[model samples]
Target: MLTLLTGLAFGLSLIVAIGAQNTFVIQQGVRGEHVGAVVAVCIASDVLLIGVGVAGAGALVAAAPGLLTVLRLAGAAFLLGYGALALRRAWRPGALRADPSGAAVPLASVVATAAALTWLNPHVYLDTVVLLGSVAAAHGADRWWFGAGAALGSVVWFTVLGRGARLLRPVFARPGAWRVLDGLVALVMVVLAVQLVVRPVGGA
Candidate 1:
C-alpha cells in the first residue's frame, strides 16, 4: 500500500507538469473533438511505458545513446512543426469556437496527433520508463504495484484534464481566450522543441 501511494505521488509529480502531451490534451478537451480518444491514448501510452519501465526496458533504452539522439531530433522536429501550426492558428484565430459542434477535427487526425505528441517526446520515456523504472527497482517485488499505482495516476489525471476542460467552455466561447490558449500552446511547443535540441534528452 505504501509502495502504491509512493508510486502514485511520483507519477503525479512527473505528469502534472505542463508539457506537450498535456497541452494537446487540453486543446482537444476544449475543442471537444475526440476528447475520449485523446485521453485514452494518453492513458494507454502511459501504462505501456510504465510497464516497459518496470520490465527493465529502461536499462536497455539508456544503454543506447544513438536511439535517444534520434528520438530527440525527431521529437524536436515534430514539436516545431506543431508549434508553427499553433502559432498560425493563434494569429488567425478562425476556429476558436467553444461550441463542440463547430468544424470538427477528424477523429483519425486527432488520434494521430495525440499519439505523436505522447510518443515523440523523449521526456515521456525519461519520466515513465527511465525514472519510474529506476524508482520502482527500489521497491523490489512490489514494483508491479508501484507501476499499477502510476498507471492509475495517469488514468485519473488525464480523465480529469480531458473531461474537466469542458467546464471552461463558457470562457472559451470568446475568441480572445482561444487566441491566448493557442499562443501559449505555441510557446510551450517551441520552448520544448528548443530544449530538446539544446539538451538532446539525457545528453550532457
Candidate 2:
C-alpha cells in the first residue's frame, strides 16, 4: 500500500507537468481525432519507461553522467525545434473547422506522431526511467509495487486529459481559439526549451 501510494504521488508529480506530449494529446482530443490511439501510445510509453525504472535501470543511468548530459542537450534541441514548428502553424492563417462526428485521424499518422513525441524527447526517459526508477529502487523489494502505482497514475491521467479535451471541443471550435491555444503551446515549449538550455548545472 505504501509503495503504491508513493509511486502514485511521484508519477503524478512528473507527468502532470506541461510539455509537448500533453499539448499534443489535448490538441488531438479537442480535434476529436485519434484520441484513443494517442492516449494508448502515451500510456504504453509510460509503462515501458516506468517498468525500466522499477527494474533498476535508474542505477545504470545515474552512473552514466555523460549520457544523461547528451540526452538533456538532445531533448532541448528537439523541444525547441518542435516549438518553432508549432509557432509557424499558429501563425499560418487557418480557420478552425469542427471535425465531423465519428471522424478520425489516420492511424499511422497518429501512431507516428505519438511515438515521436514520446520517444524522441530525452526528458521522457530521464524522468520516467531514471528519476522515477531511482525512487522506486529506494523501496527495495517493493519497487514493483511502486511501478504498479505509477502505471495506474499514468493511465488515469492520460485518460482524463484525452477524454476531457473532447469535452472542450465545442469551446475550441470557435474562430481563433485553436490559434490561440496552439500559439500558447508553442510559447510554453519555447520557454521550457530555453530553461533547459540555460539551467544551472545540477538544476532541472
Candidate 3:
C-alpha cells in the first residue's frame, strides 16, 4: 500500500508539471473538440508507457542512448513547428473565438497533435520509463501494483483537467481569453523546444 501511494504521489508530481502535453489537453478541453478521445489517448498512453516501464522496457530504453538522441531531435523539431503555429495564431487571434462547437482544428489533427505532444518528448521516457520504472522495481513482486497506482494518477488527473475546463467556458466565451492562452502556449512551446536543444534527453 505504501509503495502504491508512493507511486501515485510520484506520478502526479511529475505529471502535474506545466508541459506541452498538459497544455494541449487543457486547450482541447476548452475547445471541447474531441476531448474524450484526446483524454483517452493521453491516459491510455500514460498507462501503456508506465506499464512498459514496470515491465522492464525501461532498462532496454536506458541502455540505448541513441534512441534518446533521435527522440530529442524529433521532439525539438515538432515542438518548434507547433510553437510557430501557436505564435501565428496568437498574432491573429481575432479569427479564433472561444466557442467550443466552433471546431477549428479537425478531430484527426487533434489526435495526431496529441500523440506527437505525448510521445515525441524525451521527458516522457525519462519520467515514466526511467524514473517510474526504477521506483516501481523497488517493490519486487508488487511493482505492478505501484504501476497501477501510477497509471491511475494519470487517469484521474486527465479526467479532472478535461472536465473542469468547461467551468472556464464563461471566461473563454470571449476572444481575448483565447488570445492570451495562445500567446502563453506559444511562449511555453518555444521555451521547451529551446530547452530540448540545449539539453538533449539522456545527455551527460
For every candidate structure, what is the RMSD over all alpha carbons to the true structure, in angstroms? 1.3, 2.4, 1.3
lDDT of 1 by residue, 60-118 (tens): 88888888888889999999999998898889867466465453778899999999998
lDDT to native, each model: 0.90, 0.81, 0.88
lDDT of 3 by residue, 36-155 (tens): 989999999999999999998888888888888888889989989998888887789766765765667788999999999999999899899988999899889999999988998999
| 10 residues in a row with least lDDT, candidate 2 | 95-104
Candidate 3 stretches with Cα past 4 Å from truth are none
Which residue ranges in model 2 land beyond 4 Å of their true spot? 95-105, 200-204
Better TM-score candidate (2, 3): 3
State every prediction's TM-score relative to the real structure. Answer: 0.96, 0.87, 0.95
Is candidate 1 or 3 superior in lDDT? 1
In model 2, what lDDT does residue 3 have? 84
Instruction: State the lDDT of candidate 2 residue by residue for 24-47, as single tens digits.
Output: 898788877888999999999999
The TM-score obtained by model 1 is 0.96
| lDDT (C-alpha) at residue 97 in model 2 | 50
